[model samples]
Target: MAVLGCYINMVHPVQAERRKALDRFKEQIRYARDFGCGIIGTETGNVHAEIIYTEENFKEQPYLDVVESVRELVTEAEKFGVIVGIEGGVNHPIHSPIVMKRLLDCVDSNNLQVIFDPVNYLTPENYMNQDVIIKQAFELFGDRIVILHAKDFVIENNEKKEVPVGKGLLNYNAVLPFIKTNKPYINILLEETKEPDIIDSIAFLKRIYYQTV
Candidate 1:
């Protein structure tokens, strides 16, 4: 039980009721705070299934809806003195670095921060430019990152699939330095890995992490 933070499923179907979602999130905040956890993490809602990244979808009302919902969640988080971490991805409303920054600025709360997962932002077209994307994410949300998600992505059948930290396309050589330099005390949570591979993933991450720093 090394984990001192809890990741809340804020994108469930029941979250469609925005008020209920906010209430549930606030309750989770209290639960985390009472249990000695300092952070409560969640992702923005899902994107349009048919067209994930479209100009119209980005400008749609749903995006603004998520923003407003997060703003309310952050306000509640402030009262509990627990951090509300938002994990953004290409399939969610806070998709890009720009949108992430915008949300941070809009929320304007010290308790509101990011749970960064680089693999979530990677797309087939931007896979080659991963260095740029990773750098931009650190630069834009560096001060706002409270937790880091350790995972990797692979292209199978022309679709992205999550894999263990070192088993896929993520370049830890580049990512580790950014984390070490900018959020040195941040917690790195492993995801998308089998239980048997957790130890190996942690060892691999620690090896690169120490080597980078």
Candidate 2:
């Protein structure tokens, strides 16, 4: 089944009145489960919790709440028989994949897993051990990976911008061989394929994926 993710803002800093937003996120996942998808993925909190090892905005509440949010969703997702994957992405507050592993350990839900896209963490400002970073992520998350995001990055305006997958430096076509070798049945979710070309990209990915199998 194709995995679809939604950032329902399960945990956002909306004072206290908007508390219902978290439940709404859970409902969205329940609906996704009804549609026959085995997994529903989510991005971490909008504020990069201190997990990235940056001293900026390193507070205890956001750190504790992000885990609580994942736990709540995963608990409900288990009732629906759907797995939940928390994505590690670009510009995310919890940018380090290793910190993500630690958070996963704290939640430790049966329905919880990882959805990864390594290039999302890539930034031109700091090369910061890219290969070792990826290898370590796989070492920690290989077993829990339930979905992959197919996004590529390019340096633009001094920051990474999303570009079409095959056109960018990140290697989706090459990554395929590795993913299938490790986790043969995991779903690959494509993002940021311009509206005009989404159909083509999905079709192209299917062709390449099947050819390898």
Candidate 3:
């Protein structure tokens, strides 16, 4: 099981709180091997004290803050041979494929990698272009991605509202084919999907995965 150190806000606007979060994340990195997991996953978070959506997170300093925090985590992870798998979202600093690519370039460490969740990257404004976005992510950092989060979403009131996998707008065809070609056997974690739905989601993914050839 991978360590889900996903709550720490890597770009907290407060310096002290940010440091504390980093320390806790480092602690997780140090002990991940004991848990038989090599990778610890997290999101490049928002700038505000509260983890809410804000346009300010799309600015330069929050992105820089994430870079700094990730670099530190990567350094600590390298010593323990743990990988830091960072996920991006529309609401956070590393908000898209391009920004995620920039952070990867800036960190420049093999210990630093991606936990790609296509639904997390989707916004109402961009969900319609998901095929393009998914293609961009694979083209940019498919090799860097160590985990995939499987979920789906529906558009409601012009917002992207998440639902169980295989019950919404995500195109597994766009995702699983790439996984089959370039990332076979990679771990796919189900996000916010439960019981009976989980079984169906698995069946849905397997059907496409086997047909991708």
Candidate 4:
């Protein structure tokens, strides 16, 4: 079995408590290296608020905090020769392709990378134009994407809900080709799947994979 990466959970926002989180992240990096995996993944912890990213909450302070924290984590990850993959989303501090690019530029480490999940970056305003968002993600960070997550989302009752792959509105038709042409060997992980649903999700992704080729 291929273990592309291991995830590190978010830590508490308190400044004093960040040490423990960094220790755990370092441990995960070590574990990934020992297991022969090249990547370790995580979301930026909710440092400023529970739901970290919002129009009002999106500011320079929080972004700098995340960038500083990741800079330290990348230092540790470099020791293990493991890439640190930050998962971006609308809820996290690194919310968009522009922000992600900024973080990468700030960190300026090859060991730092991205775990691309297109659905996680969507909002109500941009969900309908997801093809453009997906394209932008690949265009901006394609070289840094270590893994791609396969999932779907829908706007139900004016709330966006994640569903099984191919069940929701994600356009695998666009996503698949981008991955095939740019990062053919990147791992595609199926998220939100149960034991019974795994088979169908795998089948759906495989069909898309072949069709994209």
TM-score winner? 3
202: Cα error in model 2, Å: 6.4
- Candidate 2 lDDT tens digits, 38-147: 87777765543223434332355555667787888888888888888788654454567777788789988868888888886677764345666677778887778887
lDDT of each: 0.77, 0.70, 0.90, 0.80
The candidate, 2 or 4, that scores higher on lDDT is 4
lDDT of 3 by residue, 47-116 (tens): 8888898999999988888988999999999999999999898899999999999999999999999999
Arranged by lDDT with the best first, the candidates are 3, 4, 1, 2
**TM-scores, each model vs. reference:** 0.87, 0.80, 0.97, 0.91
lDDT at position 213, candidate 1: 54
Prediction 3 TM-score vs. true? 0.97
Candidate 3 residue 41 C-alpha distance from true site, Å: 0.7
Cα lDDT tens digits, model 1, 43-113, are 77654433344544356465677777787888878888888888888777778888899889888889888
On residues 1-213, what C-alpha lDDT tens digit does candidate 4 reach at each position? 234444432444665566777777888877885677888788875645354445532567778878877988899888888888898888766778888989999999999998899998888778988988888888888899988989888898888888888788998998998888888898898888667778888899889988886
Which of the predicted structures, 1 or 3, would earn the higher TM-score when compared with the native? 3
**Deviation (Å) of 145 in candidate 2:** 1.0
- Deviation in angstroms for 57 in model 1? 4.7
Candidate 1 clash pair list = none
- Span of ten consecutive residues with least summed lDDT in model 1: 1-10
Per-candidate RMSD vs. true structure?
3.0, 3.9, 1.0, 2.1
